[model samples]
Target: MTQAIPTPQAAINAVAEATQQTPRKITIAMAQYSQLPIGRPFGCFANSVRHIAHETGAEGRTPQLIAFPEMHLFGTPGMTDDERHTMERSAATDLHDELSDNFAALAKELGVWLIPGTVCEKNPGGYVFNTMPVYAPDGTLAAAYRKICPWRPYEQYTPGTSLTTVDLPGFGRLGLTICYDAWFPEISRNLAWMGADLIINLVRTTTPDRAQELVLARANAIANQTFVLSLNAPEPEGYGSSLLVSPEGDVIAAMEGATPGLLIRTIDLGATRRTQEHGTLGLNRIWHQFHPEDLPVPLPLYGGRIDPQSWHPRHTAITAT
Candidate 1:
């Protein structure tokens, strides 16, 4: 069960108040890249990295971290349902480690953190899981997040048991969430409470509803007072609208409907701290004002009892950093 977050930004606000480190800023690349032909994964990903790196370098800014859409390692869509099915099943259910190893090596060679996207891995027990792999610049597998909330009645994969986050040495901590998982407020709240300064949401929406997701991206950012980068699959495969949302709930960069584009932005971690220590527009102080007297509050959703010890906000109200 998740700890009580009286409001969305409460946990992050609590975390923001306790920290005193100098603010961190890192440039991140969101590649709303469409799937390629059903073949090897290295070429497409590597080429995209090289091209993007070179392009950004021309602008005198190199992306430190790069992310693609959900299931990006999987190939492009097929014409018929059967063709697409064969393409996906054959690629995802393979018993090889090439995709993982090759990408790991690529990240090391490129010297950039990479979130290539999720895959249906047939791990040791022969059970398939929809998992997202995070590769560090050193090529080590930093973190792999399995999809906890699969699109119900449609996606029948094993659910991930634990939430995952990655702490960069220089940059701030990052929480990972996939597609449908973004729909649940509890997921981001738990991540924010767990000390994530940024949340990366990988999306793969083949149908419509990306508009709603756009709203969720902003809402989650505002609620947690944390940076959120939502990368969606490109064009036809997905209704593209990838965005980089700031802690202030502002859309720093947004792509138009069902179109492919790239976004690179250096985010300020100090903003989250500022917002948390202060408030959204200096008005919403839901995180800083926790009251023990409210323990009797009943939550019918989860047996209607808010634990004071567990629900207590972790930080005291402070005027300044």
Candidate 2:
């Protein structure tokens, strides 16, 4: 028989209790892959999650969190309106129902929190949003964060408006952000202000920008004085540079390229606290120390008449003749 999902509040409590105690060691799993058949990715994702946890646990290290890349379910672009609608209606099974249950069950069974990165979520607006849902160890939903900014060519997705964080019992406060959102510094600052000690960046990106972005992740961690777990998908869909950066901007664990596997490492939350306490001078420095206002804005590349198609095709042909 299956078990019931816990209320959001209960899930919050479960996480809060887990973080409050000591020893502060946690393992994060990042699964990298390309686009697969519709709904086929979930099976692979589940297997990867289970395998990573088992391997880490075998090493006597319990995985407190497991994270995947953005839009792990719906694959990449190519859905028509009708197909999108179908996906929206069947979201429970296709997107969350089974995955949530499995992760919750796994979290309960393995005693670890699962951050399944961002999934394709159908909102009431008839558009899908990239959203991340966090599961506590007790088979409960702790928190969910939708991507605030959608990348180019994905203007169809609805943007999220709120910034939220969840308290994890043994991990301190946790914040979630997906792919493109990491490029925006304000989002990370806001989460830090909200008391987030650990931020999980779930991404699916391509090269030749992968190495550069990995550096950015480390910079964000050092600036925020918090732990950053950047979980990315494998190529050709994404450049796999899954990394765990410490509060002082040290790369604790990382994996490069489209290799299908997991990178397990121990993170000491106490070190984060220590960095924040003793490194206040470095941490408190303003980001834009240089006067950005001194730079002038560039002119527009093109300026043309508003109505370019006003001339009829027949008239243009007659003029040419």
Candidate 3:
């Protein structure tokens, strides 16, 4: 039940009014960066971001939107014990003022919408949440989405309580979900149902199941009939096949290696409308036929009257007086 922020709509209207004629095509860039040290996450990340802007800006082709990978402020997945200790303290201390303002300034300076992926957002009580904040070209805070599914024992960050979407000028509505959130199909479907034209997966994958995740990405695009952008970190632990899948489940562009590089592509926004009108396997039609009120949620039907104590016999025995 994440509430829609008023800023996105206001920004969308402002852009639309300013640009007059709606843009049919948009350029998007994904920066697949080598992981930086935890001690200097902000400075290192800013440099990598500038690399993308420089490469594209020099070509006289500044992207409308730029995407970065998840949990950037905390470094990558495999950090040393000292690194982790340093990251934890830094996150709890300067996350709000320093890290946030730096990214905002970057977007404003470059004049491009930037998704500087997940920040280790710290709360007043010393608790942290994995959050992604979207900055508009004018350095305005457009929208932010917290990671709904934090990778369990490996990442003990707080789970998000809601789903949120942001509206771009002519890009239609944009949805944000971080790494582990890609594994849950329901969340993507929900975003699509809510009218998200592009669903961006800001990921930090470090597992051997990269192939499986690739399939899942295509499946998500096909099912939702929306463009899917899977941006991954280029860490040694990261599987750097960052991809952009179209509504028809086509891989538009994919990074070749775990090297520092940029995946730049111009996509026809009009294609999203055309492809979704007649979805693959008629999914769009099928989606409209179901009503939430009609669905039934029944209790566990297996006549389960067993005592709670019977479930964990070994644990009970171990703790017995």
Candidate 4:
């Protein structure tokens, strides 16, 4: 059964109890790969992961967590809306099953925690979702999260309603989100508020937007006082600025915009705790200030695709043709 997280005060207590002993060093592997064709074979990518794991898992140090970019399995980087829709339907039916199985096997062989990016997941009801699955070292399906917000109007993938976090035994708790989900600060903040020590945001963004994505991720890390890993694909179609950010808002390790290789870094969780304890804004204080009173929650109705007005009142229309 999944562990139920308590309120903010309880979360702080959990962190305090968990941090009694000196935290162990966790080696993270950020596997950067070039974007492939829409219908590429899953085995090709699985083999690539196996090879990288073999190479990195040699000698004394092996990565504890290995992450890949979102939509790493099949992508339509330069497709028209009609083309993308058609391909999405075809790939959802053809590829999701085989690829998911291979990822499980790969994780078991590697003996490491794996987040093998997002894939087109077909539900029993025929709705498709962009889902990211987390695999434990023994090949068990630890946790999975569907992309809460797909990329604007371009991808019409189904959005998931809930969030999930995975526990890494002795290491710490981990939060997983895919692609555009990072754009919403609420997602990462909720994760951290729930006692997640690390938040991993996977993406397949373009080169021009890489810098913006990095800054967004960095801010998320600093605000939450948690380590953030933003893993992205390689250029030219995809910018490979896969990043690992410390709780102090520092970029600990990152890949170049066009590089395709593994970035391995050993991080200590003590720093994450230290940052939380001595934060610029005290989390405990803020939590208490907002918690006692009965408050009404407001839900805004008209900002996104649901808006009846197509034209922007303040700016020029930038909708894709």
**Candidate 1 clash pair list:** 299-304
Task: Give the winner by lDDT: 1 or 3.
Answer: 1
Writing each residue's lDDT as its tens digit, candidate 2 over 72-102 gives 6655346776676466446533235666677
RMSD of 1: 6.5
On a 0 to 100 scale, what is the lDDT of residue 166 in model 2? 83
Top-down lDDT ranking: 1, 4, 3, 2
Per-residue CA lDDT of model 4 for 266-286, tens digit only, reads: 787555655566442223322
TM-scores, all candidates, are 0.83, 0.72, 0.77, 0.77
Q: What is candidate 2's CA lDDT for residue 59?
A: 47
Give model 1's TM-score versus the native structure.
0.83
Positional deviation of 39 in candidate 4, in angstroms?
4.3
Pick the TM-score winner.
1
Rate residue 76 of model 3 by lDDT.
32
Off by over 4 Å in 2: 1-23, 33-36, 41-44, 57-59, 76-99, 280-321
lDDT of 3 by residue, 1-321 (tens): 996544645644543443333345668888787655556756677777776776653235668788878865566356665667556656543335866788889999888889977777777766677888999988888987888999887777779878878877755677788988999987997787666778899988888777788898999998777889988887574888899998778898898767667877877654554455534432343343434445443336544433333211110111101
Span of ten consecutive residues with least summed lDDT in model 3: 312-321
When 3 and 4 are scored with lDDT, the better candidate is: 4
TM-score for predicted model 2 compared with the true structure: 0.72
